[model samples]
Target: MKNRMTLTFDSRSENESLARVTVSGFMAPLDPTMEEMMDVKTVVSEAVTNAIIHGYDSEDGKDIELHCAYENDELVIVISDNGSGIEDVEMAKEPLYTSKPELERSGMGFTIMENFMDHVLVTSSPGNGTRVELRKKMVAKDRVCH
Candidate 1:
């Protein structure tokens, strides 16, 4: 069985860092490469930021849930929010397509996610909510025994 942990936090901008750090700490035992560590952190940041900004529309009192698990060389993460869900999941994944252009959003959340993780799955429904599931296989590190 994979070791797993779940976090439920308020959808606050400051909490984004908290989410990143939490995952960083959780994955410590894997001895992931520096680049792998950074990639995981970046994806977590993007997912949390999207939930706070787009899903909840930056409203307070909303909860974002993050679940993380790892077994051997693979890591899995899922972030979800119960805010305003996405209407078109396919279009939302397109590059340079953002619903909130007025906010200067780059619309690259999913793009960046896909670039970093081995698998990215997004599920949402208008007024229902959004869930981002990410999976990555950490590069094996040469273990030297003394």
Candidate 2:
């Protein structure tokens, strides 16, 4: 089975959960394991939160895009924003390196995503935009026989 979805919404903190729920609901038919579901949700939350807070710098009226595709036991998720892009992608991915230390951000967004997902890719330029791609392979739960 193959399934895919794309969502676009205003870059707001409140809308972050919407992205997570949408992906979770989309993946329901696959009967993913509980751990897989939580991992997916966690990565979605991190990517969407980064798009709103870091990509757009909490500026209103900006748009964030989330795309999810499931095929052959693999799930691909892409989150993008057309806002101030990262100047240093490598540095940003380092643990505990937040751009907004004043906000008490731990700067672990990329790290968390990398740890949870099988593959992660980040692309950004200074003035263009930022895009985060996350991929995970779902292992089907073993059915118990009575």
Candidate 3:
């Protein structure tokens, strides 16, 4: 059996938690291991942060959309925003590379997403928008303590 869910939220750091909670709820029924939960949470955080910081430039009223599908023994998450897209995605992926150096960003958003998820794909264009998709294998819980 597989499950799917999608959520849209305003582009704000505060709303990142909502995204995590929604994903956590969807995965709860699957009884994911603790490490799986952490991976999901971290990836969601990085994606949401990118949407707010890079996409929207921390501007208020922008929107971010999150879509998740659990199927084929895997969990796939996609985060999208209709804000200023990256001009150079390849450069952004480099370690310690950041356009907003003044903000003290580590510029590791894409890198972290790649590391945390089994697979990550990014699509974007200047003035168009950005979408980050992450996929991870779902490991079913092995023990049930009641």
Candidate 4:
């Protein structure tokens, strides 16, 4: 059986945790490991934070959208913002490359997503906003009790 969820919220920094928790709950049926859960939450945070900070410049009035779909062993998530889009996605994906350096940002958002998820796809235009799609396949857990 396939399951899906969508959440749209204000582009506020405080709402980042909300997005993370919502996704984690939605993924409960997957029986994901603690590490998998944390990775998913962290990626959600990164995407939502990017929308709030970089996309809207921390303006706090725009909207950030999150869509998730999953089945028995696969999950796919897409987070998008209709704020200022990326000018060069390739450059943005580089490790330690942050456009807003003065904010003390680490610029590891994309890198982290890439590391944790099985696949990451980014699409953006200068004025069309940005979308990040993350896909992962869950591995069966080993329930060995010693």
Candidate 5:
């Protein structure tokens, strides 16, 4: 079975949870383990946060796009933003590299997503936009009810 969903919302901090919850609910039918579900939610949160903070520079009224597709135990997620794109994707992926030092950003968003997901790909260009693609293979746990 294959399932897919696409969501576009304003780039706001409050909408971050909305994105996470929507993705989680969308994947519920696959019977993913708690750990796997959490991983998905965490990555979604990170991507949305990056879109708002770094991509759009916290500018209101911008739109952040999230697309998810699940098939054959594999889930693919893509988050994109039409805000200011990344100049150096390599440097941004490095751990502890924050463009905004004043905000005390840890700059571990990409690192966390890469660690949790099976694969992570980032495509961006200055003044263009950014698209983050994450993929994960899920194994459904056998539930034993008492």
Candidate 6:
């Protein structure tokens, strides 16, 4: 088991960049490799972007929550939104699949997250909101000296 951190922000596209910065700071002390840190940063961005674009429809006043916990040599991140939920989880995750293709979305959010994170899970239902959880194991063998 290791340290844990959580962050929450209102549904605002401008806030997504800040989320990435914060996640970087949270994982920095762990002395993660540049690639690992980038992976975490990208996953956080995709999750937040999905919540903003799909979950909240780029609207304001809603909220998104991000939680990070380290345990058993792995880091777990949970991104959740309180907005219109997904109608179909399986279909949503398919490669090049997106509910907002008209907006030019590549439907690669889930794919990128799945590829970068060791494990990814999505749960949502109409009017209930959606949650995307990702987990990645730390590869460093020695104690990280920060």
Tens digits of per-residue lDDT for model 3, 1-146: 58787888888788989999988988776678898899899899989998999999999698899999987568889999999999988988897898999999988877888888899899999999999989998764565652
lDDT of 6 by residue, 103-125 (tens): 99999989999999999989899
What TM-score would each prediction reach against the true structure?
Answer: 0.95, 0.95, 0.92, 0.95, 0.95, 0.93
Q: Which ten residues in a row have the lowest lDDT in candidate 5?
A: 137-146
RMSD of each: 1.5, 2.2, 2.2, 2.7, 2.4, 1.7
Model 5 bad stretches (over 4 Å)? 143-146
Candidate 2: which stretches are off by over 4 Å?
143-146
For candidate 2, write residues 1-146 as lDDT tens digits.
79899989999898988998999998887778899999999999998888888888988799999999988689999999999999999999999999999988989999999999999999999889999999998886674631
lDDT of 5 by residue, 1-146 (tens): 79999999999899999999999999887788899999999999999999999999999799999999999689999999998999999999999899998998998999999999999999999988899999999975675641
* Candidate lDDT values, in order: 0.93, 0.91, 0.87, 0.93, 0.93, 0.89
- TM-score: model 4 vs. ground truth: 0.95
lDDT of 4 by residue, 24-138 (tens): 9999888889999999999999999998898999998798999999986899999999989999999999999999999999999999999999999999998899999999998
What does the lDDT read for residue 55 in candidate 6?
Answer: 94
Which segments of model 4 are wrong by more than 4 Å? 142-146
Q: Going through the candidates in order, what is the number of backbone clashes in each?
A: 0, 0, 0, 0, 0, 0
Give the 10-residue window scoring lowest on summed lDDT in candidate 2: 137-146
* Clash pairs detected, candidate 2: none
Q: How accurate is candidate 3 locally (lDDT)?
A: 0.87
Q: Give candidate 3's root-mean-square deviation (CA, Å).
A: 2.2
1-146 per-residue lDDT for model 1 (tens digits)? 26899999999999999999999999988888899999999999999999999999989779999999998889999999999999898998999999999989999989999999999999999998999999999887786641
Pairs in steric clash, model 1: none
Q: Roughly what TM-score does model 6 have, to 2 decimal places?
A: 0.93
